[model samples]
Target chain A: MNPLIEFQGFNKFFGQHQVLADIDLKVQAGEVVVILGPSGCGKSTLLRCLNGLEEAQGGSLRLDGQELLGPDTDWRQVRQRVGMVFQSYHLFGHMSVIDNLLLGPLKVQKRERREAQAQAEALLARVGLLDKRDAFPRQLSGGQQQRIAIVRSLCMNPQVMLFDEVTAALDPEMVKEVLQVIQGLAREGMTLLIVTHEMAFARAVADRIVFMEAGRILEQNHPERFFTQPQSARAQQFLEKFSFVESLPKTLHKELS
Target chain B: MSFDTAFMLSTLPAFFKAVGVTLQVGVIAIVTSLLVALLNATILVLRTPYLWRLVKGYVELARNTPLLIQLFFVYFALPSLGLKVSGFAAAIITLTFMGGAYLTEVLRAGVEAVPRAQLESGRSIGLSEGQLLRHVILPQAGILSLPALFANFVFLLKETTVVSAVAVPEILYTTKNYIALYYKTYEMLAVLTLLCVLIFLPLSLLLRYLERRLQHGQFGH
Candidate 1:
């Protein structure tokens, strides 16, 4: 079967600095691909290119056999098919949780309010956030807000979901709740493109690990093999840092992005 | 000539009647300015191609020039060019022109103040520019700029004084007409100042109440 998402010789640049160089990657339907890399390794940039958030300067990016790398591309329609959840859980603070979830379905897709609202409530319940439906974002905890963020995207019913270090901004206690939501999607066979620094989650969740360094895919392999026997020296060195106990407050690491 | 207290008292009725005209121009101008400002602010924030540049140019021109000159241009210069605008029409147009540019800046700052992540997340779900605007951008912008918008509202109303130059026959126009006929410049000027205070005191209080109501409604805080 053809890959649901494919990138060939994909290139992106910021001025003279080329961030993604000749990237080639593919994900089959129902595949869970976790990108592992050090900070500023362009892992997030690769996912962003797929979401059409970052424009690729050259090369072809095809989603479900449709080329998305030209001026003629309908980014709005493309976005509907690919939902993304950000690290900070950027929910609309002014809106209720249900409003945040129903916004895309009702306004963008022009779906029926009752239908869209039912989906929103069901998804909120799935995330164990049904009680918070009428609650504003600020009234919720960080973890609760992030789950609502996930449901907000899920309400769109996208073909692929992108998690851009979603739990990176959460407290350690809050991280588990958010990660479980993604793991639930994976268990149900949702196609996911994840960029994360969570080494353990990467090992447990990823069907295949895509290790990146310096804007290039260094290597990719089964998570079991990649963890037990890293194929590259850099991958070995990268995993070693995670082996040590983390002592620094997460607030210090917040600046890493 | 003991301040002509009786004459000033009699003309109070005239100022009261003229207040209606002033308010008519103020209300219409406020609504027009708000609409214009919203459109321009959206154009600027969305980077809507050539139109953004045009809006920016209009904003700069309107902001830098005086309101009186703009009124003169609409009332005088346009007539010379065969446009022949009415006095009230000229007042509303010129006032909205000046107020729109100022309020556009106020609102653009408000819109831009919304976190960039809010916009990115909105786009992630395929919200068109209009959807993002209505659902995400404006609600936040409207609140963020509320205080400033009210301040500008008051400024716009006060700027109606300049419309008298166009023979708009608003409050200040009536006052000037009486001042010229009776030569009661000092007494009339005093009355004008008092009338302005009277017009604005209730308005300021009402706007403050509205600002609080909206903030509470939006935030539930």
Candidate 2:
């Protein structure tokens, strides 16, 4: 089967500084891909490129076999199918949570207000935030706001969801609830591209773990193998910092070298 | 030789009537200025290549030059170019344009004050550019700029005094007439000053109240 999303020879530059260099990858439907890297390794930029937020300077990207690179792409339509949640909740502060969720469906999708509101309430309920329907973003805690931000994107009924460290700004206690919501989505088999430092969540949830550095994907593998036996020296070193060495299965370590 | 108290008292009624004219001009200019300013501000914020430059030029021209000159340009210079308007019309038009320029700057600051993240969220949700501006950008800008916009309204009120140069027969125009007839420059000038304070003090206070209210609305505190 064709990959649900594909990147071929993808490259992005910020003036003289190349952010994504010759990136190539494919994501199958219902697969959860976690991109792991330190800061400024272009993990966020790579996720942003998928949604056409950061236009690629070269190469091609395809969603369901349709071209997604360059200015000619219908970004609005692309965005409708590809939702992004930011590290900073970015909920519309001037609006109530319900209004925040309803806006895209109502205005862009032209969904009826009654229908959109109904869907919004249902989605909010699933996240256990139905009571916050009338509350403004500032009235909610950072965790509640991030959950709302996630559901706000879900309201668009996106085929693929890209989360850029959605819990990075949350308090440690708050991070669990937000991750719980994401894990729930994963269990329901939603296609997800996640950039996160939550090693445990990535281990439990990601089908494929992609290790990246210096604007390139150094290696990618199934979660068990990648965690237990990192193929690249860079990946091995990164896993060591996470202190996975103590947990590394002996047989897997022999295969890794 | 002393102050003609009786003459001043008699002209009070005419001065009051002229105050109505002044208010009418001010009201019309305020409404029109707000519309023009909001549109001009959107243009300035959008920064469309050549058009933004044109708007920038207009803002600079209107702000740098005196209101008196702009009125003169509208009333006299435009007529010299064969586009004639009544003195009242000239005052309103010139005030609207001048107020709009000032408001563009005030509002552009407000627009800039809106968080970039909010705009990005709107875009991510697939809101069209127009929807983003309407739903995300403009509401926040309106709240942020409300106090400054009110101050501009007061500024426009005082600037209406310059309208009398074209014989618009507004408050200052009629007061000048009383001065001419009775030659009581000092007394009439005193009355003008008192009337201005009476009208403006309350408005300035209201502006402060509104600013507070909007801030409270934002914080819900």
Candidate 3:
């Protein structure tokens, strides 16, 4: 399958500090890729660049054949095609959950309110949040807000979804529920680029794993090999020190072997 | 010194007449000032460097100088500049511009308080700049600005007393005529002060209540 999104020689700078340097990556349709890195490794910046939220200093970035570098690039169209879920769950505080979900489709796609409402209701149901359609973001738990955020993006009918540490703010108990919802999306063949620290979820959902450090990719491999037999010394040291890194169950290890 | 009920009863008709003019000036000035304030605040927020500097200079000059002096300038100076306006029109224009200077700052704070995420969400949904301003930013800013706007109106009401200096025949001017003719300075001044309190206190309370309600309703959503 042809790559749906590609970044070649991506370089980003914030004043004098180089955040992301000489990065190259590709993601194909219906493939789930998870990026893992230390904090301040420019993982979030990389995702922001894909959606045109943060302008890159230098690189050739493309989403489904369109270049994102030039001033003439239609950013609004790019954003519509690639929906993003932020760590903060930045729901419009004045709008209801249903309204939040409906806004993109109604405004960008020009769907009728009733039709958009129907789509929002169905999407909410998929995220197990149909009962809270009229509720506001502040009224919901962090996990519920994050799930509604997920449904909000899903309502846009995006071709590619970028999840940026979406569960970082959730309580430990609530993390599983969000991860489960994302796992469901992965099973349904959504093209997903997830930035997460949850080792278990990353191991379960990500078809390919990319390990990054100091603004560059260190290793990329299948989840099984990446975890059990990391080739890069950086990846091996990273796995050794990661707080949640315990070897997989004997049965799962046997399956990988 | 007799407490003459007949004298008080006789004064009622003229008092009511003066009250009518007071309400007219108050309402007209408030509406005019609100429109001017909205325009001024929008220009300030847009911050087109040259226009922003000009607006800033105007606001500072208007706010720093006395309202009475501004009123005198509008009433006396403009005619010398070959622009003739009636006393009432001059009074309204002066008060509107004066109140607008303060109101612009109130509105600028309200507009700035809007979360960055809200604007991003609008852009993500592909709202045009005009639609975003009208449907998203302005509504939120208006809600936030309501309390400050109401306070400015009260200030404008008090400042309308200055128009009496320009011989506009508003409440205070009419009261001055009564005091000069009837020699009931103490009684008339007390009654006029009471009238202002009666008119503004309740309106101020109502505005406060509305502000609270709007704030709660916005957060509740």
Highest TM-score: which candidate?
3
Residues B93-190, model 2: lDDT tens digits: 99998998898899999999999988888888888889998899988888888888889899888888899999998889988888888788988987
For all candidates, state DockQ relative to the true structure. 0.69, 0.43, 0.29
Predicted structure 3, TM vs. truth: 0.90
- Evaluated on CA atoms against the true complex, candidate 3 attains a DockQ of 0.29
Q: Mark the regions of model 2 whose C-alpha exceeds 4 Å error after superposition.
A: A70-72, A239-257, B1-9, B74-85, B183-187, B207-221
Candidate 2 per-residue lDDT over residues A123-218, each given as its tens digit = 999999999888888889999999999999999999999999999998999999999999999999999999999899999999999989999999
Off by over 4 Å in 1: A62-77, A245-257, B1-8, B35-54, B72-90, B165-168, B173-190
CA lDDT of A99 in candidate 3?
Answer: 75
* TM-score list, all predictions: 0.85, 0.88, 0.90
Which pairs in model 3 have colliding backbones? Answer: none
Off by over 4 Å in 3: A228-241, A244-257, B1-9, B213-221
Tens digit of per-residue lDDT, candidate 1, span B64-86: 99999998899889988889999
Q: Which has the greatest lDDT?
A: 1
State the lDDT of candidate 3 residue by residue for B77-156, as single tens digits: 99999998888998899888888788888899889988877776666555667767876788788787888788888888
* True-vs-predicted CA distance for residue A86, candidate 2, Å: 0.4
In candidate 2 the C-alpha lDDT for residue A88 amounts to: 93
Sorted into a CAPRI-style docking class, model 2 comes out as: acceptable
